[model samples]
Target chain A: MTEGVVVVGLNHRTAPVEARERLAVPPDGLEDAVRAVLALEGVREAVVVATCNRVELYAAGAEAESLAGELRRHMHARGGSGVTLYEHRGEAAVQHAFRVCASLDSLVVGEPQILGQVKEAVAAARSAGALRGRLGRVMARAFQTAKRVRTETGIAEGQVSVASVAVDLARGIFGDLMGRKVLVVGAGKMALGAARTLARAGASLLIANRSFDRAEALAREYGATAHPLTDLGMLLQHVDVAVCSTGASGYLLTRHDVATVMKARRGRGLFLIDIAVPRNVEPAAGDLDSVFLYNVDDLERAVAEGGRGRSVATIEAERVIAEELSAFRAEELAQRSAGPTIVALRRRFQEVAAAELERSLSGKLRHLPEGDRAAVEAMLDALTNKLLHAPTVALKTAAANPDGDDVMRAARSLFALDAEPADPRGEVTRMRVQGEMTAKAKAGNGR
Target chain B: MLVGFLAAAALLYLIATVLMLTYLVGVASTLPSRRAATVSLGAAMVAHVTHDILRWVTLGRGPFAGIHEGLSTLALLVAGVAFALRLLGRRLETLGVFVAPLTLLMLLASQGVDAQPAAPLSGALLGVHVGSTILGTAAFTVAFALAAAYLVQEREVRQKRLRGMFQRLPPLEVLDVASFRSIALGLPALTLGLVTGLSAGLQEVGRGIPIVSWRHYLALGVWAVFAAVLALRLLAGWRGHRAAIGTIVGYASAVMVLVGYFVRGARL
Candidate 1:
């Protein structure tokens, strides 16, 4: 039977936010919980990746099915009852690990936060001494895949967040915003956020609202100038950029006002960002020479476009993940298949050496010296290592390939290792031979 | 050697034209491939330069003296400048596709014309006129490339709703600024060139070519169009699609003057 790693848990898809919150492990409790998972019968290794959107326990064991049920029970006892658990073994586990790290499986698709979270989880597991061998390899592969996905895909094309989208449009018009004027036509949360984004980009800020007092108070936070709505026309002629998000029912700046401002500014380019629900800048104002207008809908369209671009990257990432996992699974299976034969071969060699030593020392060497006997034993040990070196290397190479099991069976039959499955000393020989063959297969396939 | 070089340059010109068409139709993905196409044109340019240099060395006179050699040398200069810009990371690769074909056409037309050099001019004023006009033409060649990129980008954004193309191309605002930047630089150069040409004509007195000849008139018209574009951009903030189209028109008229000279030289 092939030994494998399995992960089971509920994410945003299988569980609602309330259920996930109840199941969420505090960062401090993660290590202790992972230890508890290792305590389960047949669990060789374990790690818990817990986030706001997902709670998954990844475990490796000879008896994966039993370990999975135990993990599910532990999660339920921790108050995550009735949550769906998807089981992935071997290659499936590897691919799932990569997908999680890449953010292809993220709720926001291409948002870059999840990879760091996964890295933290892996680090915590390593420090706890719970990560070893297969689990460590899987985690490393996941990190690599995530990096490749970012480099190869246009997933991160446009700004998805509101503040960033505003900044993007602003930069498009102004090129470099340093020393440029940006007028904020409202003092609401979004306007404040947009103001912060613009100010950070080195644009001088002007806040205009119907309630001048609130606008003044908000403007003071970023050291910006404040103006009442009546002065917006005058402000428009001076500012290079404007962002309007007033909860106005109708247009605050009409075509006539924009035309007059354009004439006054002598046709210097103006960028208008309208974030209000009912729309603040009149659509006709866009027709003015040197005027560029973008409403909420345009920003939303850009976000959607960014999302689509990320999806294309996601497809490419999934293909890479699948290929990597398949290679990993094949290597694991090959090594596992060669285990018994390697042990048998080593045991047989030791038996022959021991018999020869007993015969030689009983009378002929016994009459000589104890030092002489010890020297002969040392010589025998060296001879055994030298004789076994090539086969051992070959077996290990075979064990690491996709078809490693076939190589292992051939090695076992050729060496007559199938005759003895028990006896620890004999089993060592069998497993050693099998391990070497598996390793050899892996090496050959790699070429 | 001259004939072999001319043939290779013509072949490269044809390849660049095909590649540019493929790129404009959205069949190609990377800008570097278009840039590679220009490298081939650059190889062709090396050959064109060699041909002109060989003629000058063998005949023991400046290649710019005859209408045949003058037009050919100008074409070689244009291609050389275009290749230099491509090396400097200017995306004027597509411009070579348009320019190399025009250059080759001029060179081929020159072969059929009178090979004799023009009667030597009397003063340094004529040299200044010729030098400035060539420099102005080179500047306009770059302007034409920027205008072409703008037009292609505009069409792709409008017709395909292609976010990839939209993002890949510089922003519309950036393109408009670049176009103005080119024209602003080119206008003064052309003005100096035109003024020097008029001065040269005055120095020659009755022996001077007519200012109202088709070649001179086309050059004047091209200068006027560029002047108008610069005024509109500065005074009215004319930009985007309209500005791009204006640059294309202005540059096309300038190219017409070069073609006019070629045809007239052939008949003579």
Candidate 2:
């Protein structure tokens, strides 16, 4: 059988988010999307991971080059011609899967959510019957590799995002947010995201936006309280964590205002996360005792620190992925070698056993006692098993080693089972040619 | 033969420690690395048990006769308990990196203590005192390991660098709960140990040797630290980094009590 895995699509690195969004399928539509990709010619299996930042389609088939083209056409038909696509076949495809699952290829490397997103995509494809054969196994192995990369490497360590870093700093101040109050100074998207993160960490949310309607609406969504922007100082005294994001040109809270708030709070540590562009919270406020003020620059520094940590982990994860890829390739080759040959060998043996039984039953065995004929059939079954057991074991053992293809080819030809399975020599030659072509293309693209 | 067994067990523990550290460093793949370390530890445990059995049968005495034997047994119990925790799906196997090296040290420390044949004592109080204290110490070792992991994980979160070794560790809440649970389990054992030890000391006092000693005071110190830790945790909602640090301090005091015995050259 022809076998290969290929991934062809665009991500945030290759295409803009708008292009990804155009191609993006929601969770509910993922199954239909996977089925759509599977419907493309020459594609045996397909899974589409469509997140906000990326849209990737991974397909496995006997002919990778054609399948990649078909996938490109399918994506273009769905997402428009403007979407820039990248293609990875064979070992590269498997590596891409591992990296994607491990979150190394994410918009923000080491982010944890990509693994879950990939798993969800695979699940959707499986439910739709779009994932089958070696592709499913490959994806499953990818998940395991992803999990390994996560635990073994610091790839997923630290809070890389601005909002999450704010939440993390807040957590450092208060070990657990069980009954801690969090105040949102503005009801903008950044503030909303920060509030949601704090809320998820079990902090009580209170929204105070200049626009009362927006504050009330956002607060109602989170089942939180809404206060007027005029009462920000009073709210700060009551809350442990405060997130400020607004469109104001000047600093929202001066150092004096924060110092006053700290005095009223009676030495309770106040964490202020300022995510505004023009700087919402005063910089000098961070110097106050019991006040932990982190503006956009500070959050970026935290993010950069996390990025450095992940980079160190990424080197280790890359090494692990390389190891996994080699092992996976060997296993894939072994399975590909043994699969059709095993089936054909079993069929040939069964056929011979049945013919012998039929001939004996119709002639000499027909005259024997019923017990004797039954005994003969049982003997034949045992004989077949005994005859095949050694070769079956040997074939499987050879498949686990480097000389698997040679042994598989020898067994196929010796047993006259060459017609069913693909010629090993021919497959190897094709793979080698494809590999060389890919290398040339890469070298050319380097220019 | 017993020495051979001890050396082999120590070597196996060293190998397991190396494997665990490799896994902790994130260079090794997750599943195979953990499996290798766990198998090595299991083999080491088997070797350890064999050594203990041979020492007991050959010497015609209980396992806790000398500091040499007692330290070996203490390491075995600590490792066995940590292995059991691993089996319970606690995701605490990474702690083997700490536990294995410490266990090896404990086994090596046994070499320094003279292995004189212990006289057969004719009292149940002695057995209760020694056995309960050893078991309590094992429980504390496990708790200390968990507390150490909890603090490391807490630091990673507080610092905002989340990959590699940090990712391999159990979550903060899980480690916190496990640390407290180990302490909870240990406290009762320790109390029983202290009660039995005091009783045994009274019996000894009647025979002319003083009941109170430096070890006795150090034991009280261990108990006091744990009591304060547990009380603060239960009543005042003391959980997280501070609680973990307290657990470490408490375990340190417990270790110091053992050191007190070692320094005084006492064998009981």
Candidate 3:
């Protein structure tokens, strides 16, 4: 069977944020939770990524289907009872890992938070001893691919957030915003966010909402002054930029009000950013001389354009991940085969040496001194190496081939090493095998 | 030689103008077989330069003299600059559609007029006025072409609901600023040209002579329209489609003045 990784979970795709949140583990609890998952039956290694948008567990095992069911039950027991699950094994798992790390699977397609989330999850898994050789290598490759996608494409170019888009449109008209005054037309959260971004960018701010107290509170948060909606025209004359995101159903800035302001201001440019759903600025404001206006739809278009370019970069990133995962899988399968082959070869050599020592020591070595007998035992060890040299070389050669697993099973049976299995209940058995593999790999690297 | 050069140059410009129209109307995706549209425009510029040089060599004077030569040289300079900008990889091929036709019209109109050179001025003031005005008008021609492109792009976006085209065009704000800057550069040069022309006319007549011809009236009208455009751009902050329209109107009036001068003699 091909060595592979499998992940099963529901994200923004199969479950809403409410369902995802119920099953989410805090970052501090991630390592302990992943450790519990690794203790489950048939799970060899595992990593769990819990976020506001998703709660996914990625595991590597000889029996992926059984382990995936155990993971689903684990999540269900953790209060994800109604959450749906999607499972991907082998190549699909590799591609999905890359997509998640690159933020293509984000709530807001290219949000940049998913990469950090994935890295934190991987680090937690490693500390919990849930990430072993193959899965660890794959996760590392995924992080590198995400970095490549961010730097190579125009994917990250242009204003991506609503506030940035508002600021960009304002800059288009006024050329600069250092001393320009911006009036926020509502106390809504989006308006406050946009106002804050503008304020940070050096535009002087004024907040005007229908409720005087709420506007005053928001204005105080950003060190700005507040006004009521009745003073909008007065505010319009004083400020060069207006951002409106009120809950009102109709237009707040009417044609007559704008016209009156335009006449009063003597034709200085006015940039209006209307981020309300139904739009707070009148469409006709765009027709006025020196009045440049943009609505939510325009900002959405800018965001969508940026998302599309990022999607293209995501394709290149996924390809890199796939290549890395394949190389890691090949190395894993080779190591798995090498384990049984080396164990069997060692047993066969030890058996032959024991039989030869018994035959030689029975009469002549029995008459020697105790120190001389110890030297004779050491001499016998050097002789056994010369005896089993050909079979050892052949076993290693067979284990390196693509069909190495079949060759390994054959070697195990021929040498009768499988007569007794490594103790499945002994955790030390698996730990020792891992330690030996690391040592062998290190020795090979030294060569 | 001058007539032959002028005929060849006008024909080349007319062909380029048609190709540019084709490209602008979205019928041709790529320029026909000549590698790119820039090559066709470059060929037109070469023929245009040949026409200007032949006129200058035959008349034994710069082509900035009478109205016919002045308009022809202005048109040639505009096409040359536009072509040079394209060669520098500005993707200004769409602009050629608007400018080449204007250039061709000027060249063809020049063909029907007399080519008598201007009387030599005793002062360097006239030379400075003529050189600056021609360069300024050349800049205005480019501004007009950019404004026309912006208007067409904006209309396309509104009619087709193509958001992509909206992003592709220079922001309406940038187009407005460019139009204002070009006019700002052109207006002072035109003022100097008018002052020098008045002084020269007064010198020739030995007194204040009554300006009676249509050419003089057209020149004064073109200057007045540009003056109004500049004043509104600075004071009123007029921009976007309205500014684009104003630029087109002002440029058309300026071209008409050149045409009026070609129909009547320079000294009329």
Candidate 4:
């Protein structure tokens, strides 16, 4: 049988966030979910990659169709309704895994968080004892491929998030952000995210909110100081970048306030990131000298343009994924054939040992007690196991190399193990061609 | 032998300029090392100083005597000021992408000046006049580089295309402050230099020699432009792109005054 990967998942494109949440595996529940999936029939290895926008189970096994059904039942018991489940097997599954790890399949393609989430999923499965062998190797290689894609292609080019784009705009206006002071007008999510990005870039953060306690709470989280809303004017004068995402009915910062601040600032450039829905900063404030104001719409336009630029690099990104998938498939094929070859070789050794033990038990050991005869049989079995240990390890090691099939062929012919049943998928024949071509290429290159 | 040193300095300046340009364009995956660029530029300055001293010794005159010496001295002063500003902070180092090429051009132009027999010694007034003006022009050159960078970076912000070159430049505040400080120092030097030149011209006229030329008037015009920029900035708070463009115009006039010497084929 051909061993392949199977992915059964539901993402933002296939289901709404509400539906995804119903199937999402919480951090505390991840190990249990992975263990449950591994207990199912036909799932040789399992990893549950669950996030806010997606819930997916990836497995490596002989049967994709049945394994997907088993995963679907697991997902069904978890309370997802009206959600479309996507099932990808073999090459499609491998391709899907690569694309997801590379962030090409994210809701916002080219976003970088998915790769880290995938790593976390793999770690959880490993701790849960559900990740092993072929699946583990494939996932580890997928992480490397993701990193290569990020470095070699523009897949991760530009800031795609509104918060990050705001920070980028601030840098453009301020050059280096180190030691620059930033003022947050509210403690809302968008404002906080933008502030965090700026703070990470070395800008000092000052949080100002309507509620003093709320501002203090967020300030402690970011290791920043909190100020009252009334201090906005003083803060604006001292800050290089100010982000406003207040939940107010009117503008939090008006043209007159910024004009006064600019005079105090001596016309130093002030970047204002207004991410609120109703717009916190006054539009006319941007008209003031040395004030660069970008509302949510402007940030979205930048994000959209950046997305379009990244789409241009998709062809190259897809080519990278294709190369990684081919390597993974070849390795899987070799491992599959090597596994059966090891089993057949062990069986052949056991048959000869058992035959020799049977003759001794019936003739020479006939006078011995029943307990001694059983002990002799156990010794023969142990000897057979001990003899196969080095060869088993050698065969697996050879399978990882280019000429692994030669070793398999020699062992089969030498032990007459070919008469025994082996892998039903015909991987032996595929590996034969692959190994011979590789060896031939190496020989030709040497000459 | 002096030409060989000049060639080495020019080559080093060219490399530094190329590295800075590459950094501005964001073509390199990693940032080009600042230490390498700084070392290259510093070595270039040392060689240029060596070339100037050697030429001074060989010619047995001051480095400001002829068009050749004037150009070389001007290049050295401009590059030295730029290097000093860079040592103050890295934000000004990007200005080298503009300053280094201009320095190389001046050095190259110096080679084109014809060697001539030394004239009779000039008065102390003439020495004071020429030295102060050269120093003032060097300060103006540094100001001009900062202004150009400010305009480029400011345009990127206004257009909201914050990538590549925009990302490499100093902040608008930093550029604006540096430009103003340069003009603040340069305007006084230039004013003093112009006054000395006027005094020198009066002395030459007393001796019945014509010393007032278009270059003198152009130098006065350059002073007037910077004076107006400084005056308006102090009076009206003119501090951004408009101020930058004004400084650039002033620097342009100063450069034209230098070019006037080469065009007239006269000794300074």
Can you write out model 1's per-residue Cα lDDT over A1-447, one digit (the tens) per residue? 223578888776666545665676666778887888888777787888976568898988766578778877887887556666777765567678888887776644665767887887888888788887778878887898788777776554532445676676666555677888999998645566676788899999999988989888877877998888899889998998888877665678899989999888876778787766456788888866567776655554565565542556567767777766666666555455545556567777777788889888995777858787898999999999898887777777787765656876786777666666345565565556566676565444433
Per-candidate TM-scores read 0.54, 0.49, 0.51, 0.53
After TM-score superposition, the amount by which residue B29's alpha carbon in candidate 4 deviates from its true location, in angstroms, is 7.4
Better of 2 and 4 by lDDT: 4
Instruction: List clashing residue pairs in candidate 4.
Output: A1-A424, A1-A425
DockQ of each: 0.11, 0.04, 0.12, 0.25
Clashing pairs in 3: none
Compare the candidates by TM-score and give the number of the best one.
1
TM-score, predicted candidate 2 vs. hidden true structure: 0.49
Pick out the ten consecutive residues of candidate 3 chain A with the lowest summed lDDT: A420-429
Candidate 4's residue-wise lDDT over A69-171, tens digit each?
Answer: 8888878777554568998876677678889998877645676777887898899899988776768887887898898889888877742655677767776
> Model 4, range B1-268, lDDT digits (tens) per residue?
9879999999998987887777666665254466677788899999999988887799775776654676788899888876775677655667888788878877776676665412222566546555676677777888889889988888777667666666667878778877888888887877777887677676777789867767678888999998898888887777887789999899888767556554554445
Could you list the iRMS of every candidate? 3.9, 6.5, 4.8, 2.2
Per-prediction backbone clash count: 45, 9, 0, 2
Candidate 3 interface RMSD after superposing interface residues: 4.8
Give stretches of model 4 more than 4 Å off.
A1-179, A197-204, A210-235, A248-264, A282-288, A295-447, B1-23, B26-47, B66-68, B81-93, B108-124, B160-163, B205-210, B266-268
Report the TM-score of chain B alone for all candidates. 0.81, 0.87, 0.85, 0.86
> In model 3, what lDDT does residue A201 have?
83
Candidate 3 overall Cα lDDT vs. reference? 0.68
Report the number of the highest-DockQ candidate: 4
